[model samples]
Target: MNILVLCTGNSARSILGEAIFNQLGAGRVRAYSAGSRPKGVPHPGALRLLERRGIDTNSFRSKSWHEFTGPDAPPIDIAITVCGNAAGEACPVFPGTPIRAHWGLPDPADVDGSKAEVDAAFEATWLALTARVAAFLALPFEKLDPRELADHLAEFGRMEGAA
Candidate 1:
């Protein structure tokens, strides 16, 4: 399955979601991320967090959703908005009418504090997404009907943060 994760900035939450999905998906799912207004580079703290998890931070980048709208773009099996801003913004209609889900998360980049505090926010968001994604992968992908899959995906989004 090909998935596209989106945010307003594409710097933190969305970037982390892309990396986590790519790692946890384990080649069965191809994950990509883009933003409505990209930050031009992945957030340094996001890079550090992924590095701590031993996931490669190289391919992650901040890009525009337009990159996925062209004819040559990869067909996204799913498109997820990782923040409320991007979720509310107008998005390009992807080819194939991919399943769209809103995994609303607080933007770590918006956190105002010292470096350590900022890092903590990013870590929290990362953990929340990881939990939801892990649950998502546990589903019986081949057996579920589209309506069932959509329901499952939406349920994944509604999951609260881990205690």
Candidate 2:
């Protein structure tokens, strides 16, 4: 399945999500991430966190959702919003009418104070996203109908760290 993760900035949570899903999906799922209003760069803290997890940070970038709206865009099987802002905002129409869900998370970039504190916030975000993504991968994708799949996706949003 091709999955898309979204957020307002696309720099932190969504970027981390793309990395985690791609890493953990083990070839069963392909994931991408975009933002409503991109910040033009991935957050430094997010990159640091992903690198610590052994994810190649070079492939991730902050991009706009418009990239997925074109006829030539990759067909997205699912779209997940990782922040409350993106969840409530207007989004581009995906090419394949992908299943949608909101896995709201607090923006780790919004955390203030020392470097250690900032890293801690990003770590927490990573843990929460990891849990939700693991739950998604555990689903019986081959047997579940579209409605059932969407229902299962929605339940992932309500897991720990829900915003």
Candidate 3:
């Protein structure tokens, strides 16, 4: 399945979400991340964290949602918004009827303090994403219809620390 993770900034949470899904999906899913208003680059802390996880951080970049809306774009099977702003905002029409889910996560970059504190916040967000992603991947994807899949996806969004 092709999955797209969305956010307002495409810098932190969404970027992390993209990485976790791609890593844990085990080639069963192809995941991408984008923003309504991109920061034009992935957050430095996000890159550092992904690199620590052995993810080749070089390929990740903050991009716009429009990239996935074009005729040539991949047919997204699911679209997940990882922040409130992107969840509430209207999105461009994707190539297919992608299952939409809102997994609102607090922006780890919003923390104000030393580098260690900021990294801690990012780490917490990463763990939360990992939990949600793992749970979703555990689902019986072949048996669930679109409605069932969407509902299951929404359920993941409501977990503690996700909102």
Candidate 4:
């Protein structure tokens, strides 16, 4: 399965979700991320947390959702929105009917504190997103129909850290 994680900024939460999904999904799913308004680069705190976890930050960059609009873009089987703004915005998770789920989270980049506190907020966001991604990776995707899969994804959105 191919998945796309979306957020307004694509700087923090969406980036974290992308990493978590890609790492845990292994070769079972290909995950990508984008934003309604690209931030150009990822948030420093997010990059820090990812690097600390030994996940390569070199391939990550804040990008627009339009990049996936081209005919050459990979087909998305699922599209997850991690923030309200992107969830509400017009998304092009097209070419087919892809399951959509919202896993809204408070932006760690919006946290105000010293280095440690800021890093802690990022860590918390990471953990929350990790939980949802891991749950999806654990599901028996081959058996579930589209409706069942959608229901499960919606249930996951209501888990901890839900906004």
Candidate 5:
């Protein structure tokens, strides 16, 4: 499966989701992330958090969803929105008519506090997204029809830390 995660900024939550999905899914799925309005850089806090967990941070960047519109772009099987702003905006049509779901999450970049507090917020977001991704990875995707898969994914959106 190929999944695309989206957020307005694509700097924090969506980036985190992308890393988690790629890390956990490995050979089962390929995950990418983008923004409606690209921030041009991944959030530093997000980068630091992923680095702490030993996930490769070299490939991450804040990119526009428009990049996936080309014929050469990888077809997406699913598209998930991780922030309310991006979830509410109209997204570009992905190549494969990917299933869509919203897993609204608080943007760790929006958190305001000491450095530790900010890092903690990023850690919490990472944990929540990881839980959701693990649940998704546990599903019998090969056997489930699109409708069943969509329903299960929707349920995953309601897990802890849902925004």
Candidate 6:
């Protein structure tokens, strides 16, 4: 199955989600990312965080959602919005009847302060997405129907960090 994770910037949360899903899904699922408004580059802190986890950040780039709407574009099995702004905005109509879900995370790029503080924000977001993606991968995909899978994905969106 092919999945597209969307956000406003396509720089941090969506990028991290794509990488995590791609890694955990193995060959069972392929993941892609796009944004309502491209940031033109992956966020530096996001790159650092992924690198620290041993995931390559070289292939990531911010891209517009329009790329997924064309005839030659890959048909998306699922499209998940990973931030509040992107979830609220009107998205490009995907070729297939793509299942939509929201897995909103706090925007690490929006966090301000020292370099250490910024890195901490990105790390926290990464950990949150990693946990949710791990839960998603644990689901029995072969047995559940597409709608059920979408429902479960949405449930992942609502999870809060352990206090």
Task: At residue 142, give the lDDT of candidate 3.
Answer: 62
lDDT of each: 0.89, 0.93, 0.92, 0.91, 0.93, 0.90
Residue 148 local lDDT, model 6: 97
Q: Model 1 over residues 82-139: C-alpha lDDT tens digits? A: 8988999999978888888888988888888888998898899998999988988898
- The sequence of per-residue lDDT tens digits that candidate 4 reaches over residues 1-163 is 9899999989999999989988998889989999999899999999999999999999999999888777888898899999989989989747678889999988899999999999999999999998998888789986899999999999999999898
Tens-place lDDT digits, model 6, residues 1-163: 8889999999999999899999989888899999999999999999998898899888999999999999999999889898999999999888989989998888999989998999999989888988888888888876789889988998888888521
Query: Model 2, range 1-163, lDDT digits (tens) per residue?
Result: 9999999999999999999999999999999999999999999999999888888888889999999999888999999999999999988889878889999999999999898999999999999999999998998786788899999989999998899
The list of candidate 1 runs beyond 4 A from truth reads none
Shift in Å, residue 155, candidate 2 = 0.9
User: Which pairs of residues collide in candidate 4?
Assistant: none
Stretches of candidate 6 above 4 Å error? none
Two-way lDDT contest, 2 vs 6, winner = 2
Better of 5 and 6 by lDDT: 5
- lDDT per residue (tens digit) for residues 1-163 in model 3: 9999999999999999999999999988899999999999998889889888888988899999999998899999999999999999999999879989999999998988988888889999999999999989999986799999999988999988967
State the displacement of the C-alpha of residue 48, model 5, in Å, after optimal TM-score superposition.
Answer: 0.6
Listing every candidate in turn, what is its Cα RMSD in Å to the true structure after a full C-alpha superposition? 1.8, 0.8, 0.7, 0.9, 0.7, 1.8
**In model 3, which range of ten residues has the least summed lDDT?**
43-52
Clash statistics: count for each candidate: 0, 0, 0, 0, 0, 0
